[model samples]
Target: MEDGGQAQRAWASNPPTAFIFLITVFAFFLPILIYFPPFPPFRRDALLETHVQVGIQHPSESGLRKSTQKHNAGRSVPVTAEGTARNNAKDGVEETPKTSTDGGRIRSLWIYPIKSCRGIELRQSRVLPTGLEFDRLYMFAQLRSPFPAPSSPSADGSGPVEHTWHFITQRQFPLLATVQVDLFVPKGEADSDKAASGAFLLVRFPWKERGLRGVLESAAAKLSRGWRAQPEKEFVLPVAFPVGSSSSRSPSPVPPGSGQESDAEEGEDVEIEDRRPRGYTHEKVTIWRDTVSALNMEAELPRELRLYLGVSNRLGLFRVDPARLREVRRCAPTPAEAGYQPVAGFQDAYPLHLLNLKSVRDFDAKIDKDKDLQELDPRRFRANIIVDNNDYSSPYDEETWKKIRFTSEPGNRKESNGSNDKKLVPSTFHVSCRTVRCKMPNVDQDSGYRHPVQPDKALRKFREVDEGAKRMGCLGMQVTPLFTNPGLPEGRKSWVEVGMSVEVLERGHHVYILQ
Candidate 1:
C-alpha cells in the first residue's frame, strides 16, 4: 500500500512522464483507428430502400394460375381477347393495369451487335420476331489449333475442349467489355453512293503491348495520370444487309497470315486500313448446345486486335448466317402449338430478354452488407428491354406475366386503313420462361473487371424458385413474339420504342423447359 501511494505521488509530480505514457497508448492504436473506423465513410443506402418486405409468394397468391373455376382449374383455355375480357369481368377479376395510366414504360433498349461485347443503347428499335434487329448478330470465336491442346492449368477446370470453333464470352475473356462498337446507318442521298450504300460499324479498344514501357503506360492509364497515355485504337468495317440473304457477297478464300505480322511488342499504333483485304469466309461456330454456320470476318481484322484480345492461337469474328437459321429449341412450344419454331441469331436462348428495374433494386438490397459491394448496375444483366415497373409493379412480378403487349403513344401509333389494321395493333409477345442466370453477369461492362463472387452469389440465397431448374437463379423473363405468320409483309412490321406502355395481357404459371 505504501509503495503504490509513493508511485501515484511520483507520477502526478512528473507531468512529462504522464504525457509520454498517453502518447504511447495513442501511437499503438493509431493504425487500427485509421484502418477500421467506427462508421463507414461512404453509404449507398441513402437513395435506395430495401424491398425485402414480402417473401416469395405462394403460387395461388402469385395470380399466375389461369383460373380457380373447378372445370378450368388445371387446364388452359384458349379464348379470344373479347372472350377473355368478358370472362374476367364475369369472374369479378380486374385486368392488369395499363402502363399509360400507371406510368410504367420502357426505360431503355440495348442492342448488342457482337455477343458479349459492348452494347448500344437506343431510343427506338425495330422489333422483329427474333427480337431487336442486329442484336447478337455477331460473335467472337477461338480458331482451333492443328495440334491437340494440353490439359488446362486453370484451377476451376473450365477450359473448353471437344469443339473446333467455340464462342467466346466475358466468362472466358472479361476484357471483351472494354471493346466498343458504333453503328452508322446511311440515309437519303448518302445511300445512293456506292461507298456509303451500307451501314458502317466502328470498333475501338485500348492498345495492348508488353514490356516495361507498355506496363508503365497501362499503369498510368489505370491511374488516370495521362502520362504517356496511348489513344484508343479503332477499326471500321462496312455492314451490308441483304434483302433476304445472309450476306451481301458469297464466301471467299481467306489466306492464312494475310496481313504483315503486327509490331505490337514495341507499342506501335498501326493504322486500321493498312492491315487487310476485305472478305468473309463461311465457318461453323458453336454457341452453347447449338452449332450454326456463321460468316467469318477475319480478313477485315488487324493482327494487333487479336493480340490485344489475348488470343494466342487464332481468333475469328463470326456473323450470323441467315440461310442457316438457328431456331429457338429451348422453352419453345411445339410446331403444332405455335405453327412454327421461332428463330434467333446468336441469342443464348430466347429472342427477347426483359428485365424489371424494381427487381434489380430489390436484388441490390439483398447483397451482403459485410462484403461492402458496390451498387449493382443494370448493365450487368444485359437485357434487351429495360422496363421501369414504377409503382404499378413489384419485384419479381414479371414471373406471373404470361403475355405482354407494348402500345405506343397516340402520336407514335400508326393509323391502319384496311385488312392490315389488325397487324398495326400493339405488339404482343408470349412470355416463354425464366432466364437461367450465369456468372457472366458478374463482369463489369464499363471496366472489364469481374468480381470474384457477387450478385450471383447473393442471388443464390433466395432466387432459385423456378420449378424446372431450381438449381439455378433466375433474373429476367425470356419472351417470343406471338405471330400467326412466320413471314410477315412490310406493312405488318412492329416497332418498340422507349416510353412505350406495357400491359400484361395474360397471366399463368410458366412451365420452364430447358433446352
Candidate 2:
C-alpha cells in the first residue's frame, strides 16, 4: 500500500497535466474558439473619442485681424474731397495751404479715377516706391508675368508664355467690372483724438484686367481709332493682383470728360459692358505686406499680386510738396481777398498755371523739394506752398509776389505757415516776378468727348505738352503747344502732330541767393 501511494505521488508531481487539460478543453469548445465576441462592438466609439480629444486640443489656423472695411453700395458714391465727407469728413479739419510746405497744415487733394467715387488720403506717398501702392495694387493681370520672348517655340511651335492668361473681359467677370481704389494708412489713436485716425483718399479707378481676357492693350486699341491688326493685338497688358470676391461693380458715376480707353469690336454697349468683372480670374490685390481687397473672384491665381506700378498701360497721378517753393504766399494776396480780377480783353493772356507735383523729376531743383515732390501723394493734393512761380501757387496777379526766405522751418514736411509761426520770411525781401499766357481747347456742345465711349477724343496734344511745361516751370514757357494747325494737312488732332516752344521772359538764376 505504501509503495502504491509513493508511485501515485510521483506521477502527480511529474505530470504534464496543464497541457493535457488545455488540449482536452480546446477540443470540446472548437466551434466557440473559431468565433469572436457576440456583444455590441464599441471599437469605433473609442477611436472617435480619441480623435475629438486631439482635435479640440489643436485647432486649424485661425485668421488674422484686418482693418474693418466700409463698403459703398451699387457704385460711384460721391466722396466729398474738401474737409467734409459722409463717412469721416468733419468741419474742423484744416484748409488747403498756399504758401509753404510747413506750418500751415493742409490735407491732400484725393482724385478718384471713377467720377464721384471716394478715395483715401495719405500724409505722403512716394513715387516709384509708392506710386503703385496707391494705383496698380488692384488690377488683374492677363499675362501671368512679364513674358519671356518666344523661347525657341514649343513642341507644336505654339510659343512660350506668348500670352499666359485665358482672360475674359469685365463681360465675363462682371464682379470686377468697376473697382474704386483708395490708400489706407493707419495712424496712432493719439493723433486722431482716439478716432481710427483713418487715412485720406488719394485716388480710385475701374479695375480693368479682371477676367484675364480684356487687356489694357486691347482696350487701348479699341478706344483709339488709331491702331489695329499687328502691334495692337500684341498690346502688352499690365501687371495686376489676384482676383478677390464676387461683388457687383460699384455703381458708376458718369465718367468725367476724362474717360477710359477700351476697344472691344464685339460692339456691345460700352456703358453697360462697364459693369462686368472677372471670376477666379485673379488673386488678392495687394502691395507688400499691405493688401487691398480687389473686386475679383479668380481662384487659381498661381501668383499673388506681385507687380505694383509696372502695370501695362494705366495712367497715374502724382503730388507735390509745399516745401519746394520760394515763400511767395506771404506776399501774394489771396484771389478771394485781393480783388484780383483777371483782365478780360486778354483772352489767353493770364490762363491759369497748373502745378504738377509729379513732373518734379523733369525739372532741375531750383530749391530743395524737387526730390521730395516724388514722395508727395499725387491724389492727396494739399496746396499749402505757394510760388512766385510764373507759378505753382494759385493763379496770381504777379504784383503781389515778393522774395522771402522760408523761416525756422521744422526742416521736414513743409507747410504754408512760413515754416511754423515764424512768418513767410525772416525779414522783408524782394523778387522779380511776371505772368505769361496759356490756353486749352474749347469743347463745343456736341463734342461727344464727354461720352464714356469717346473720352480720348477731347484730349489735345497741346494741353499735354503744356502740362509738362508746367513741371519745368520756367519764368516764361518751356514746352507749351499752340495746337493750331501750324497749317498742317492733319489738323493738330493727334498728340504727336503738335509742336511746342519755350519763350523765356526772364533769364538766369545768376542772381546770388540771399539767406
Candidate 3:
C-alpha cells in the first residue's frame, strides 16, 4: 500500500501538465516555427488594435482569428506590441485580468520591429488579431556606399575615427526615432508586390520639425513630389529622453577591414554601463541644424548614418524629439570613398531598430508600475515586446509565418469580470508563445550580446529532440492541441522528424475590443 501511494504522489508532483508546459516553452524558441495563436488577422490603416484592454468584453462572433509572427533565418517568433500582454482577452489568459475590446479612450499603442530604428507612428491602426501591419517591413541590409572619412585615422583603427561600421541596427541607435519616413506611392503604382519599384524615395525628412519646415525651401528637389503626397498624419516616433532634444539623419559608413573606425565617431558617444539602465550621449540636435545655424547657434546631424536607433532594452524608453520633429532625405547613400551612407538609401534594403530584451528586472518593473495608465507614448512601458521599443511602432512587428493558437472555449468570465453572469463564452482568441533566448549573439553586434541558456537540463533534453530546429519565443508559442502530436524518440536528432510544434496556419477576420 505504501509503495503504491508513493508512486501516485510522484506522478502527481510531476503533473502531465508540467511536461506539456516544458514542451511549449522549448518550442517557443522556434519563432518562425510558431504562428499567431488563433487571433483575428490584423492589418494597418484600420483601428482594430485599439480594442485590446482588460475589463472589456469581446463578442464570441466578433470574427477575427488570424496568424502572424513570421520565421526569420530559421525559427518562428511572435511580435510584442508591448512585451507580453496579460492575456486580458476574455476570461483570464493563464493568470491575467480579463480585458475588453474597447475603442473610446485614446491609449497609446506602439510597435518596434528588429528592436529599433524608426517606429511607424499610427494615430489609429487595426490589429490583425495577429499584430501591427507593415511593421518592421523593411530591414536595412548593408549596402555599400561612397563617403570619405569624416575623422582622422586611428592607429588601432579603434579611436574616434570616421565611422567604421557601415550597417547599424535599430537596436544600436534610437535617434533615428526623430525622422518620419513613409514609403513612396507613385501616382498609380503602389501595392505590396509593386511597392518595390525602382523609384523608392523619401521626399521629406521629418526627423525634426524644422526639417519639415524646410521642405518648402527644397520643394524642387528630386524627392519632393512624394513628400507632398503623404497624408498629414501626426505619427510621432519615440524620443527616449524624459526631457531633451532631437534630429532626423541616416547612416553611411561600413567598417571595411578588421581595423576600421565607425563614421559616426565624431560624437556618437555610447557608454552603456553594467550598473545602471542604458542611456545615450549623441548631440541633442535637430535634423535641420544647418538651416537653424544660419540664424543662430544651432546643431545639425554630423553624419548621415541615421539608419538605426540603438536603444537599450533595460531603459524602457527610446529617444525622440521633445521639441517636435521635422523630416529628412530617405535618399540612398553615395558610394565612392568607402561605404554606403544611409541617407534613406533603402531602394533595396534598410535598417531595423533592434531592441534588447536581456534586461528583465528593469523592464518588468516599468510595465508593472504603469498598468493603469494609457496616456503618453506607451508610458515608456506597457510594451508588449519591449526589445528597446522607442516611442513609436516597429516595422518588423508584422508577420504571417509563425503558427499560433487561439483558445476559444474560455470556461468562465465572471471570475475575471467580477460579474454574476456565468454564461460568458470565451471567444476563440489569443496566442501562447515563449520568447526564445537563443544560444547565439544578435546578428548585428560584433561582441557582448549572448542569449541565455535554459535553466533546466531536462527541458534542454526534450528541446534537443527538436535540435537543428529554429528556436522562437522571440515570443514563446503555445497551443492547446486539437490533437497532440505523436510521440518522438528521446534523442537530439528527434527535431528533424518531430513535426508537431507547428500546426494550423490560417487567416481570420479581426475586430477591436476597446472599453
TM-score of each: 0.65, 0.23, 0.25
Clash count per candidate: 0, 53, 157
Candidate 3 TM-score to native: 0.25
- Stretches off by above 4 angstroms in model 1 are 1-103, 144-163, 188-197, 208-230, 241-279, 333-340, 369-372, 411-425, 484-492
- Tell how far residue 176 is off in model 1, in angstroms: 0.7
Evaluate residue 465 in candidate 2 and report its C-alpha lDDT on the 0 to 100 scale: 22
The candidate maximizing lDDT is 1
Candidate 3, residues 1-515, lDDT tens digits: the string is 99999987887798887789888987776443234322222111111222111111222311010000111133323335542221212222132122221101112223333233433333222222113323332223222222654344544557654321122342344343433443322233222222222112121232222476445333322132244442221221111222222342322121112122344455474322222222433322212122111011111121223322332221211222213322211211123211212211111122111122222222232331222321112212113222221222222221111222221123422222323222122112122222232322221121222213222221233322211234322322211111121122111010000001112233222121111
Which RMSD does model 2 reach against the true structure?
A: 28.7
| lDDT per residue (tens digit) for residues 374-493 in model 2 | 222222111112222222222211222232222223443242222224222232112222222111111111110111211112122212222223421122211111222324423211
lDDT-best of 1 and 2: 1
lDDT of 1 at 114: 80
Better of 1 and 2 by TM-score: 1
Worst ten-residue run, lDDT, model 2? Answer: 62-71
User: What lDDT does the true structure give each of the candidates?
Assistant: 0.64, 0.24, 0.25
